[model samples]
Target: MSTTPMFPSNLLPNEASPEWMNKGDNAWQLTAATLVGLQSVPGLVILYGSIVKKKWAVNSAFMALYAFAAVLICWVGWGYRMSFGESLVFFWGRPAVALDQKFLLEKAFVGMYPTATMVFFQFVFAAITLILIAGALLGRMNIYAWMLFVPLWLTFSYTIGAFSVWCPTGWLAKAGVIDYSGGYVIHLSSGVAGFTAAYWVGPRASADRENFPPNNIILMLAGAGLLWMGWTGFNGGDPYVVSIDASLAVLNTHVCAATSLLVWLFLDIIFFGKPSVIGAVQGMITGLVCITPAAGVVQGWAAILMGVMSGSIPWFSMMVLHKKIALLKQVDDTMAVFHTHAVAGSLGGILTGIFAEPKLNRLFYQVDDWEKYIGLAYGLNSGRTSAGFHQMGVQLGGILFIIVLNIVTTSLICLFIRLIMPLRLSDKELEVGDDVVHGEEAYSLWGDGEIFDNTKHYTEHNTAFDLEDGSSSMKKTATEVQLT
Candidate 1:
């Protein structure tokens, strides 16, 4: 009886759906966030699991899975606000809880959607960044150490980059440095942090380092396919609206990726005399990272040019320069994240400054500050050369900031974690890999119902029986045992 008379017949628009909220934008933002999340969970989880050597598969995949879950808890608890909330310093924001209903239901600072949508959307980006860092540490990093590294790196390293570049009040944003999606924030930071962590964690075991190969190439490609397709949300969702710029970003993303993949495939054929699926995947990733900062702002032709540069430049860095550089050779970057993400991300930032179209920039940034947002090409054509140079300088400055920040913060984080636990796994664990580290194997060679025994299956000296003969008396050394 009380319920029947107390409430209004219909709720007002302001009560449930705020006047400022665009239903289409909110729906698209949610969908885009889910796509990005998919790239990390099953996408990266499968990729990491199948891409590593058979013995190391489980551990590698678990690292990504753990980071995804850990980053979400930290993001909503405090990471989100520290990234996009009120400024605490020029490069950081005040940390605060993002889970409150009052806060989540409010109009977001930038988008025509609720704060909850922004929080979830941004959380996926944060989670993926940590998962990317796990790539370099795959084969040998201690899982316990990674558990600590995830939350700490997100707080000290990721938030600063995000605050400096993406937040409306961010210093770089005010200075007109453009990072359309996260070439700088996610890719560059992850690349630098990963390489730094790898240096501190040390390389995988000598044997694993020398001969590690994918356990399942077909499944690795499937995960890569998910990563490639999921980028529609990665670049497309950055605009925070379902607008023409969003469509341009989605198209540009694919075009750049496809072009870069072809260029990388052809280069592999010319140089290595064979097509490599791994090389092609690296090319696709580089293309995605390279276009991220300029996807919506650059024209279609510029996207192709960017793809060509990304395909060739990062390929050279990884295949040639990594071999020549003393420091690069010393660092054990397991997945070559430094080349795929750091180099490509930097190239994208610089390219964005050179190729960003004034009209498209205006559409994305919604700013009329012609001097600040003008790309180098447009500035030269429009007789505003100084503006273009300024933009280029800003781009370089952002890159420097990110590189320095990650190098210092990541190194410090690793050192700090080292105090509590070993950054790299013990020698015994590294040699045994997934079986020893996680008490599991990626594939069981025995019958389906058999329980795996470390002593019998993975001992330093396994006894091999010559079952081909009539007698089981003949035995061979572990090295001679070939299950296949």
Candidate 2:
């Protein structure tokens, strides 16, 4: 029935696989995006769920889960364009929906892939930033308040930072601020915004604050391993191509993380008399954050130096300085995100200006301007001292902008959310934890649909007795029956 003549031989390029599209690049971008998404979904989810007190495990993990879903919805709806669309102002982009097939199938602004790939890649970053902020508010923030806070903060604080630093037309970008990945847009912003939100949400219950311990250290390690490996995508995909720079970025990311972990472990042994696993995780995270800005721009030796500094500086900040600073002491950063992300991120930015190689910058930025992007050390050696100092100034300026932006925007968003609902949970809910708040628990091992009730058990002579399975009598000490 003339099947061969049904279609013309000369047709327009296929929409799914355009002539401009690079299949390998598209594949790697999608794979990298999935890897980044994994870092949040099961990685942070498991970490948050296992790292908190057992009573609060469900709540902590749910916060991360909800942010991931909510951010994807918002990103496709309008958030993506707001962060990367046409300029609405010097620091913001025009808000526009990113779901149109025409837009999605087109070439992306930066990568050699469809715009859809870039949107997905960027959405994972936005989602993780909100999840990081959740670490600070866990154990006490009202679910409704958090629900409101996520979209609000994403709309206000996140988009602004993303637009200002990442967008090509951004003032900061034009001014030569270097954020190879998201040391500024994600890490620093999350750390400062998280700390600020924690201030407004208030602390957890006094009892929880005093005695909180990880419910599952082993599971925490597993989650952390996922996070560590997933960073291969985090820094690698930033180069927007499958090239030598991308390979170098991936190698630097892991090297810095390992070095930072060892340094932090050694510091813990020297000062605390024990090598803390939690300390190692914090070190790894700081190293990841610190190297993000400079990953593709610095050499292997520079990455190692950055790792050492990241491990030691953030450790001291969290261990010694946090206690000494009144403002830091007042803010109850549950995950110490301020130290791991904010401090490390800013340090990375400054060091990027110091150690970034001019040749590497030309490779990444595709610019050979000797007067810009020159590291301070290189500048002195190259007789371009002005360029180096200028790069350093730009880096410092970016850090200052992020800190002030997060503090102000986060405070306003929290205050606005407070007008709609209470920011903190009720005292009873705080005391009872996940079971009271979500009507669920992380572990239901004792009985089907039943939460352990300390009030129902009686303790005498260090022995406790309570009903088991609603039909049998079980004997155990109150301490033994208590959930971990």
Candidate 3:
């Protein structure tokens, strides 16, 4: 045989080529998609595992892992088409497979790249949204029940929000509702859906809810750091090409996150008398969500103002309002996702109408409709106050639509899941946590590799108890792994 390598007969010399494609854009898009994927996989995975009670670590992490895989399978099968394909109506596209090679290689709308890149990029967002919702149900949701809930919610609640707010043909999009990268579709929807599901699934076991503590604060920070960095792609990739808007979005994202985190830390010190790392993380998340809808369209100063409001407002909701509000207290939101995502997301949408810059809006949305995208502050400056109010109205409308949509869809889905099987874990499973549920422990520390016993582990003085291997546990205390 010749020394030359053989090519498949069906493969063309430029098989990866699309005449309209920008190679750089395609590469960046794929990289961005992977970054977003990393946020859910190791980022949220680590975050969930280490942020829950030690006994629930494995279960919480597994919930996120399973959703990531499930969403991808559903995404390529029919979910992608329903959200971005041919319009089925004002808020949905016709369901169809996104896997055909020819279609995957075709140019995606707006992006000068193959449709495959768009599919993967969108899929990561879809997956992460579900994972965020999982945060609320952590420490208690039944795994098999969660398996069914993921696909169902994705199909019903997530797709509608995405198509309505993100798809070019969506009614909200046509109406010029700003959602540059899923403040409404992903963050807002996940927050609301998670809370609603939590209400229906019921609360975690009383003990777990009362005394749950993060398993590993350092590892939790590591995961949070990844999520913080991964947002570079989350907002930056929305424009679907490298440009000044992308750079502005990236800068604004970090600026807001830093500002919000400090504000939250300050609030925690003043009230709780400590600078909680978890509080700082929540503030960072709220800031990220707050700027998401207007990230590319707001000036730097406006981003700072939005960050300040996001830091304080969501803090109030989660800390003060959650305590006073009966509905909030009744639904044990294990991760406070409603405050971090839903409240912050709605706040961002409204603020987008107030802070969105006309010139930047023109650059990001590529629209010249002075009547449609002008922020309220700019409207006053430019003598277009009525137009700014209109934009605000549209933003409010989008928020209402999303909230009502999720409330109904999520409730029905949860009820359906309940009919099939209990949504929450059994009492024994809840008592034993990950070990009884999954037959696995997150960390192994027994001298003889025996299963963990709460009575023998927590509450009891392990330092004085004898090990099964006839070793004096008190002598080996320093080497033992312990839960707080």
Candidate 4:
């Protein structure tokens, strides 16, 4: 027998794939989709809601909610095609929507899964990218302006990045770059765009900064929990096929995140009096971002090391550099999007070279022939002593290119929009949050259709004076205190 393993001629088509594979793939796709959906809905949604002070609760929530909706509409309409369709002159995919059931079911895909599964899986990535961008503009952006910016950015900028990185025939993919997941496309792009938008939009109101404490810590915890769990899909869905490699990818992603979380908590205990829940969430996010590019390619041990670097480096950048470096301070990345996504993404890109294993690369590449060829170029067959390092250098180059492009493009977009319409809210609106702007509050306990409370002992708090809007005749002293 030949050294190569032999199989039946008819085995070319996957026979193990029962009709249930369609069901199974879709089930996995939906499961993964919902996990990603949770990240925005209750995950980052509540995290932002609780992290910001009470005054900006509605504002933060709206930013996340709007991005979630806006990205979906754009994805199904045009953004999806631009990323995954046949390469549009190498930079993007062909412009077309995969809306019909027949097209989705019978569509041909070159990679790990069916076309339908791939479309939905990719849609989540695009959606989350917008959600991540929303973090920077959370506290102070106008609802109208944000509503407009999401589709515009998704159409002009995000699609380009997704297409460049993921489309099989795109220039970046053809150049033998391996993202595995979304280190450059999602995290790095969002991080840079977020910082640019934040700087362009300007800081929150002075009062907001003075007392921007979290409104609801419990809600924040809910959001953080979802983010932690949702990452299984974020990494796992990349492989598309429900194979051993997919399982390994998911494991690697979690291991990195867990390791990073522990490292961050330990560091916090050493430095601060106690560990903070917020700090732990930051560590979790950093770990996820760091492992994006290397999740499938690296061993679990390498993931642990990457996790440490991600958690520590980004934490230092956010905590120390933002405070110490005046230039970074001026940028006002509202939720530290740059520190978490950009810094961690860059770190992950570099580490992918250092940690990628020979075997995993082969399995992932064997899923497609073009990938097979490129895999060989960078795999164990390469004569260069430091080929992984060389591949890593390519990854770094991609990261830098993304950063510069986002900075320039996002700044220009913001400047153009500012020239036409005001980006920040008025002084009066800033003092009051969603109640005055959207005319809707997140919660209403007394569902009596009116905010009229006539109880004798009741007191209502305002930004300035506490008004005794009650039926009582007794005089009450006004206290100038900020509400927690």
Leading candidate by TM-score: 1
**Where does candidate 2 clash, by residue pair?**
none
Give candidate 1's root-mean-square deviation (CA, Å): 5.4
- What stretches of model 3 exceed 4 Å from their correct place? 1-15, 367-371, 448-484
Candidate 1: tens digits of C-alpha lDDT, residues 62-96: 99999999999999999999999999999999999
Q: For each candidate, C-alpha RMSD in Å?
A: 5.4, 5.8, 6.5, 6.1
Better of 3 and 4 by TM-score: 3
Instruction: Arrange candidates by TM-score, descending.
Output: 1, 2, 3, 4
lDDT of 3 by residue, 1-484 (tens): 7998775654334655645788778888899899889999999999999999988999999999999999999999999989988898878888999989888888898758989899999999999999999999999999999999999999988988899888878999999898889899999999999999999999998888898899999999999999999999999998898889999999999999989999999999999999999999999999999999989999899889988999999999999999999999999899999999999999999999889888888888775564478888898889999988888899999999999999999999999988889998988678767766887789866557774453434424554444342223433453454532
Clashing pairs in 3: none
After superposing candidate 1 on the true structure, give the runs of residues whose Cα lies further than 4 Å from its correct spot.
Answer: 1-14, 368-371, 449-451, 455-484
Q: Model 2: runs farther than 4 Å from truth?
A: 1-15, 368-371, 447-484
- Residue 15, model 2: lDDT of 56
| Candidate 3 local lDDT, residue 188 | 93
- State every prediction's TM-score relative to the real structure: 0.92, 0.91, 0.90, 0.85
lDDT of 2 by residue, 420-476 (tens): 899999986777677668877788555675756543322232235533322123323
True-structure lDDT of candidate 2: 0.90
Give the range where candidate 4 is weakest over 10 consecutive residues by summed lDDT: 471-480
Task: Specify the poorest-scoring 10-residue window by lDDT in model 2.
Answer: 466-475
Q: What order do you get sorting by lDDT, best first?
A: 1, 2, 3, 4
lDDT per residue, candidate 4, 434-473, as tens digits?
6567655555434365532322224343323232232112
